[model samples]
Structures are given as C-alpha cells and as structure tokens.
Target: MINISQCYSTGTIKGVSKVGGLIGFCSNTTITDCYSIGNLEESPGWENAGYAREYLFRYFGGLIGTTSLGVITNCYSCGKVADVPYAGYTQYEYHGFMGPSEYGDENTVASLYFDVSKAGRTDNFAVAKSTQEMKQQNTFIGWDFIGIWRIGGGVNEGYPYLLFSYTPSEGLNVFIITDIGLKQVTEMYLITDMGLKKASQSNIIADTGLK
Candidate 1:
C-alpha cells in the first residue's frame, strides 16, 4: 500500500473544486501523523461562469478531498475553508478533515482532529478542537510526543509537528508525491523521471541538506 507518513502542507490552496490542502484525492493508502496548515478556498473568478456547478463532486477539505480504502490516524488540520458557492447543489460538501470516502464509512478515519476556529466548520470524520485547545498538549490524548511528534516550545503556535523535521538524524526522510502522468497504483515502487526505484531505498536516503 502507499504509505504517506509525517507529511504536511502549508500556505493557501485555491482551486475550482475538490481542493484538499494536503492531498486532492487518494485511495487505498495509509496516512499517518500528517497535518495541513494550508488554507483551502475556491479560486476567484472561476465559478459557474460558463461551467456547470452541477459537477458530480464539489468539495474542499483540509487533508483530503476523497479517500477510499485508506487508513488515516494521528492527523490534524488547522486551515481556513471558505469561498465556496454551491447554493442548490446536493453534492456540495466541505470539511475541515475530509470531503468524502468511496464507501462513506468513518471507520478508517481515526485519531483525526481539526481546529474549528480556523477551519470554520467540521465533519463527522474528525473531531473539532478550538484554537486554544489545539495548542494544548492535553488535547491530543494518545499522540506520541517522545518520538514522532512534538508541541509547544514556540513551535507551530503549539501545534504538533513531526520530530524528524526539526531534529537531524538518519531517520529523516521526505517523500515526494509522484506526478508520473497522473497514473498511480497502491504499490511500493516510485516511478519518476529518474527511473524506477523501490520505496524503501528512497526512504532510507537521507536529505542531508535539511537545516
């Protein structure tokens, strides 16, 4: 399966529809300890102007637009979701955590949270936390602080961050989402312009330039 671990997205992510701050769409993958502080908003001057707002899906999400057969855990997002116009569209839905899943099941979504104050709204897939509560360590009850994540100490406005992003070690790794002509499979191989390579070999290669 595709493994996305300890990843995050920042800044504003604007689009016509189905916009996700971290991932626009994914399926059958495992995402853990990830977050998105980026804002999700509908692109200006691009709504229903000669186009039908009746598109099958019109959504904006903090982490993912739609994920099916996926497992998400220990993830959170504190992003603003706004400027979407879908007054009469039945499929119009937005969320601070997720847009939708193929099976419409929330079982695969676990340990997920969102800052309602920043997001302005939320969904059933994730729990809502106020801005103040999001900054407190006690708010994340079962999160790992000693290893994968850390909070406070003037970091991320006290929001949790991946530990390896701050500390230098052999464990530091960064996985770039493949853009291999839009076709992807739930496999361990990363096929890029540099040629095919195993996911394990990619993960073990240190990013020594991190500072």
Candidate 2:
C-alpha cells in the first residue's frame, strides 16, 4: 500500500544490496511523478561479498531496486549506479532505473525515463535519454506541468522539480518571495494534500537577512 506522489531525491544513496535511489525494494505500490538524481554507491564492511549478495540480494537501480504488482508513471532517474564490481559468489543485477519485477517491464511503466550519461548504463527496464534531453521539458510527456511539476527558471539546475517538492527531512515548503523586499524570509506555508494552509507564525523557519 505504498504510494509516493510527486516526490524526488536530490542527494546520494549508499547501501550493500537491494539499494536504490528512491526505494530499496517495493511491491504492490504506486509511484507517480517521482525522480531521483543521487549517486548510488555500494557500502563496504559487511559479511563476505559473495555471501552477502545472496542474503542481501544484489539489486540496484536509480529509482527502485526491484518492484512489481504496481504502477509507475511519469517517473525518471538521473544518478550514477554503483555496486560490487566483483561479486563472483552470486550474480548482481543493475539497471538505469529499475531492476527485476514479479510481472512487469517497460510496458508497466508509462513515461518512465533515465539519464544514460549520469547513470552510466542503459537497459530495457526504462527509457534512456541523454543528459541534454533530460533537461528538456519535452522529454517528459503525459505529465502534469501546471499542477504537479515545474522546470527551468533556474529550478533544480534545469531538472524538473515538483511544484511542492519537499522531503520530510526538509521541514516543509518554505518558498521565498519578493513581497518582503526579497531581503529576508518572514513567512512560511504548510502545503498539504488538501490545499495550501496559511501556516502560523511558528511555521516560519527564519526571519532574518537574506543576503
């Protein structure tokens, strides 16, 4: 029952096996309008690499390690995929965006894409595009631009950014405006699924000089 809507990752993810930029392992879930652009690296210092590969399941991807029995749409990933280069004990699987699944493939995903330049590999798991193509808005079709996503305007380094993109660790959506002279931030708003709520004064993260 895992459902992730309009979420994204802009950092790094490290793990031994079943590692992913967004989700490690998922099933029967629905992920839409999501993406990840973080370097995925293998974490050393564990049991035997071979032994662990069987136990941990050597599966890595840019968005999800493995998934099935679900739907994914309008999702993309642009990150470097890394894993145990010499796991001879067992076989390791890696993909630009996703790995194995119970009953799904490229058909199960609509408008799913991955950046070949960044991920360093391309597979049939998802659509592969160049770095420059990824930055273009036209590359992402059948996506909600006005409501869910925004690109350009110096947003996310030309990458598509969710209109309300914010992880739980980032507190909440605290946008800056010019109404307050653009010199300081004295306001904050809590964006909920229902709608935007005028957050209380306590929601203000900071009210000081901007520059």
Candidate 3:
C-alpha cells in the first residue's frame, strides 16, 4: 500500500479511478524531487465532473493522490485538473497537493533562499556575500543570529552576555553568547580575523573619540 521514490501511470484507462506520478494511493513513503504534468478530469463512471472529489472521501493532486508518511521536497507540478459535478456525489474533492488518508507521519521540508544581488532573478538560490554598495553602516548591531545585522538603538535589552570560550586544536577560538541580558552591544565598529570590536557605550563618548 506504500512505496517510496517510485513512478506510476494508469495509461489510457477511463473510469472513476486514481492515477498519479508517485502513486495511485499513498501510505508511509517519502517523495522528493518529483513532478507531474498532464490532464485529469472526471471519468464517465462517476457523476462528478472534476478529476477529484473536493469535500472529503476523495482527494487528488497533480503529482500524488495522497501523501501520508513521506516528505515531499523540491517537488512541483504544472498540470491541469478539474472537479465535475454528478448526481450522487455531493461532497467535492481536492485537485492539487492532496494529503494522505490519515494524519501524523514523517513529513518535513527545507526551503532555499536566493541571493538576488549578484545573479539577479536568474540566480537559483545560491548563497553569496553582499556587495559593497549593499553594505550599509551599522548592519550587525544587536542581532543574535549569525547572518543578521541590526542598526540603530531599538535593540532588545539584556543581550550579548559573554559566555564560555574555548580554543580548539586548530587554534580556532569559539565564543558563545549564552545569556542575553539588558544593554545590548549598540554598534560593531570593526570585525576582523581577531574578533568583533564594539563602538563606545555612549554616543557622546563615540563622537568624542572620533574627533
């Protein structure tokens, strides 16, 4: 009743039956990097006009009939599907990306973000450094995350409480900011191979030192 990474087709068959790129019916399986492009409509056997029932009982998707156990990642479809009306069937069915008959299983997805500065819209979700023109002043101020830079004075209080430090065998110094306390590090003046150097605590002192 369940299969993983498999492809199937119910060639030229006509009826109130099921067909899909992955499986006619799904159970405990994972489908990744899969796709389907075809036409699906209600068969003469059923009164329903669409390819699938909408309300409940019946579900259909372009790539899969139902997903229960497996995760579908990096998968997409460009197919035409429609639901039709019949005399006996009152409940409608779904057309695209239908779920499994039951809920609760192993399903997860990891999405990628694109760097638009370098390659523009054509870039396919690649990680790249920011250009000089894109680097504004005071980018990384109070942000706790690695790749986020905060500028200005609205940083949440109680942050950057210096945690434990250790030097690995390769002479790489690792510093963890465990507990975030009030009074965030306002500005990061410089960052080099050594470490990050903060700006003055007070604006007045920072201006005085600059002069």
Candidate 4:
C-alpha cells in the first residue's frame, strides 16, 4: 500500500490489460489530489493466457486501469482514452477515470472527478464537468487553493497547478519590517525572456534591472 498526492502526468501511456494514463494497476493504495492531462493510447489486446490468439481483457482507465482495495480521492483526469483497433476484435472497452473497481467496499473511492468535454467518457464513478468548469477553482469542492494549488496565471493551461511546482525562489532578498526587528529573506532569481525576474509562490514579478 502507498500514498501518492500533489502530482500530475502529461505524457502518453499505452498497454493492454491494466493500462492507464497514470497508473496501470493499484492495490491497497491511496491516490489523492492528482490528475492526468495526457492521452491514453492502448493497443489492441495481447495473447491470452493459454490461447494462441490475442484478446483484450477488462481494466483500462484514463487515470487508473484497475483499483484493487485502493482509494482515490479528489483526483481527476482530462485525457482522452482510446484503444487501437484490432483486426479480429470488434468490441473495445475504455473509461474516463478508472476502468473498474475490482475490490474494496463502498467507501474505497470518493470525490473523484473528470472532464467530460476533454476525456470524452462518462462513468458512474466519476463526476463529469465541462472544460470551463474544470478551470474554475470552485469546481473542486475540497481542494486547497491558497497553499496546495493554483489556478490560471499561465500555469497548467488554466488547470490547477500543484504548489510544489510554484515554490518561491531562494535567491531574491525581501526586506520585512516588524515591531521586533527587520528580516531579509533571500529568493532565487529566474532569468526569463522578458528579463531577470523574481519568482514567488503566487506570481513572478519582473525585475527589469537589465536590458
């Protein structure tokens, strides 16, 4: 069992059974405050256990292929899920957030969300919302915006960005005047195309000190 949180994926994932954009299979694990923004391209099935012909099995999701005694909460996926066509098979199965919940009781998963307009899937386990709705901060009921996440301001293409990706630089000096004493904090400087800039947790302010 493991706990994963405050992360996201922006790459493609491809496989057969137990295929997903983020994690193929999860067992007794807890995933929270994560999302997948890449595409899930799964190939047609693989060789069956004993049969010579290739066949596709259950379990394929945009976020997770299968959940076995696991919990996923406050997580969402906005990736398109599709399967490559197989010559012999006519039926293809796919999902938006998760393929199937093979184990766990009723409280295993909670507050899972997905973008219906982006992922192009609707499943019972996920609450679907439009692209615009996903961009809004209020769409996520229990998410922390002040400390753990950020919206807009040229990050994640309007999607929520984890605070880990928005850490304040440790090179710039900030002078703070207090009743007790004065404090100066060093901040990291970021050289961008615009010019030298000071990066903070909320925004990046241009220094404009050099041409």
For TM-score, the strongest prediction is 1
Candidate 2, residues 64-158, lDDT tens digits: the string is 88887768899999998884566562233777898777344333678899998888765666799998888877788887766777665455766
lDDT of 3 at 56: 32
User: Which lDDT values do the candidates have, in the order given?
Assistant: 0.72, 0.72, 0.36, 0.68
Error in Å for residue 98 of model 2: 0.4
lDDT of 1 by residue, 1-211 (tens): 8999989988898876677889887778899999999888777777445676555336678888778788989999999876556645423477887887745655486788999899887676889999888876677768876677767545566677877776323332333333211111223445567877555433534322232
Residue-wise lDDT of candidate 4 within 8-91, one digit each (tens)? 888987776677778887787888888888888755444534534343545667788777777788888888876445533322
> Against the correct fold, how does model 4 do in TM-score?
0.69
Give the worst 10-residue stretch by lDDT in candidate 1.
Answer: 177-186
Candidate 1 lDDT at 145 equals: 68
Those runs of model 2 whose alpha carbons end farther than 4 Å from true positions after fitting are: 47-52, 87-92, 102-107, 166-211
TM-score of model 3 vs. true structure: 0.37
lDDT of 3 by residue, 1-211 (tens): 3434323232332224444433556665665434343444555645445544543334444455555655554343333433435434312243443333445454543321111232121211112223321122222232233322221123211111111211123222222243332222334354545666544434334443431
How far off is residue 76 in model 2, in Å?
Answer: 0.5
RMSD of each: 14.1, 9.9, 17.6, 8.8
